[model samples]
Target: MSAAIRNYALVTGAYWGFTLTDGALRMLVLLHFHALGYSAFEIALLFILYEVAGIVTNLVGGWLAQARGLRFTLFAGLALQIASLTALSLTNPDWLPALSVAYVMGLQAASGVAKDLTKMSSKSAIKVLVPANADGALFRWVALLTGSKNALKGVGFFMGGALLSWLGFSGALLAMAAGLALTLIAVAISLGSAMAGPAGGIKPKFRDVFSRDRKINVLSAARLFLFGSRDIWFVVGLPVFLASELGWSHIEVGSYMALWVIGYGFIQAIAPKMLRAKTREPDGRTAQIWIAVLIAVSAAIAAAITHDIAPELAVLGGLLVFGIVFAINSSLHSYLILAYAEGDKVAMNVGFYYMSNAIGRLTGTVLSGVAYLYGGLVGCLVTSIAFLTLAWVISAALPSRSGASTQS
Candidate 1:
């Protein structure tokens, strides 16, 4: 294999390991806390720090990765996760509610930092590894990486639930920590020193973390609403709905969610083929068209729920359709950010893009609880539609095929 391919493989492998643990951590915390009698809002609060930390981490991590090296950031991320996992294993059952919440939140913040640093490093490395002239290679590669990561994350969710049943919370966390520690050691030894080094030896300034390109800025704004649309329902609303209204068990809930995400990732991996992206690169117009369709789908789902027309079937079927389209949208966004970034500033631009992504998640997470509390699933779906519409409006500013180019 070529050196570029080798580095890409190493970076992707490391990211997979991290994503698995990250998914499991989320499941473990949500389920464990819920079982301990925490309210839905309180459970949501547990993750607030995680999303908030991502905002700062992405902005700062972009600069750090550019100055230090992708390898440095990647290693730091893994180390921090390991530390967070170990700390979490020390949680005492006898602690006060406030104390426990504070402890877990602090640890989650560290994991958030770890997640974004590793993500920014791995994604930016692709810009360096893939040749600029390779037709459609960037899209395919990014989709594959993103898709596989999500698939593995879904598996991790299942694993988290199973481990909780078998080993309880502390044991499950310790096991993940041990596994990740081994993965970290392997990555440190295997990856080359220059895997994600600074481009052209130029020292990137902190201000460069924000993008100046109009396309990137518009796309980033669209991305913010696009993701918020998904999480507004996906995060708190859907899961709580499943448990409370549908009477689904924890295993059942986890399994269904895992299946959805796995299928979503599969679609993402094959999006290039499905969308015929090879013939012509997807652009702003492509995003707008897909999102418009998504808005219709979201509206239909919401309407079905409101009218009580086979609500269960509407939700399950609608989400399947939603996942497919959303996967394509996400894959396109991933490709576009990399496409728009200058080679010398790939890390910084990616970081900025993901900062917007984190903000979207934060917004949706907060609203998920509030919306659900007020109007249940119908409320959540309405909120999702609103966000999708905003995303569609923002996407109108994106350059069409004539102006956009995927070639970096």
Candidate 2:
């Protein structure tokens, strides 16, 4: 392989590991806290802490990525993840566990921003080599990487759950710690050999590039908001609801989640074709239209989930519906962000895009908590339906492929 290829592959592998470890933690989260006797409100509080920390990190992380380059930022983030996970594993006491976990949550949030910076920066560096016709290819790559990573993390969760059943929380924590340590080691080595040099700083001059182009900026902002809402519901609200309401075990839940990701990965593979089939002009509006349709459908499906449904059937049905929604919407969202963004300010554009999603996440968690408290499943369903409606309307407002103007 060429040196560039080798380097890129190593970085990709590092990200894959990073994702796997993160997924493992996510899969175990509700169960872990529940084991520690945390209530739904407490869970929301922890999630809020996590998002609050992310808000702070997003700003600093963007600046760090601008100054230190994507690779350095990613590495630093990985380091923080390592320490944070280790700390989290050690602190599981009833009284102090939540507070300790919150601190770790903050670190995890910081790592999230750093990781986003790294992924986008790496993609930018390699964009020149990729085919121009590949509008959603980068998003496809991310989905593939993340999906596979989560699949592996599912394995980790399965093992952890079994171990927790047999050997208790300590054993589960040990296994998680081991996996994260290995991932950290792998990323450290990859960064050493693949991305040791100084990274290029962000270009502030291009920050206003979008502002100068009002049409694209407006479209981009709208798209970002729509996507932000989509992510918050999918990532924060859905998982918690299933776990709490359906009494699903982590292993069972992970299996369903794995299926969701499988469906998503399959859609990502065909995202290019989906876009092409939707439009002859190739302006990528095809992707957006499909995304809108899927988001609306997913919201509808999520709203219909209730305790009267069989656990197995509910999981499968919900997974299938939400899976389709997530796959199409996520792919299109990535394509839109990249399309609207200037090459010079790719990092910031990507960061801002994520920050928007983070904002939505913050809102979703709070709302979901309130919804669960009052109306139970109905509240969760309503929130999702509202967001999806907003997304669909915004997408309908966007200009067609042929008539679309330059997005900054």
TM-score of 2: 0.75
Clashes of each: 0, 0
lDDT of 2 at 398: 52
TM-score of each: 0.95, 0.75
Q: Per-model C-alpha lDDT, please?
A: 0.88, 0.55
Q: Which lDDT tens digits does candidate 1 get at residues 83-167?
A: 9999999988788888999999999999999999989988988888886667788889999999998889999998888898999
Q: TM-score of predicted model 1?
A: 0.95
Give the best candidate by TM-score.
1
Task: Identify the candidate with maximal lDDT.
Answer: 1
Candidate 2 lDDT over 226-344, as tens digits, reads: 54554445554566666876677755666766656555666655655655623443344554566566655655555456545464465457657666656556655655555555555
Q: Which regions of candidate 2 deviate over 4 angstroms?
A: 92-143, 146-156, 159-220, 223-255, 273-284, 295-319, 372-379, 396-408
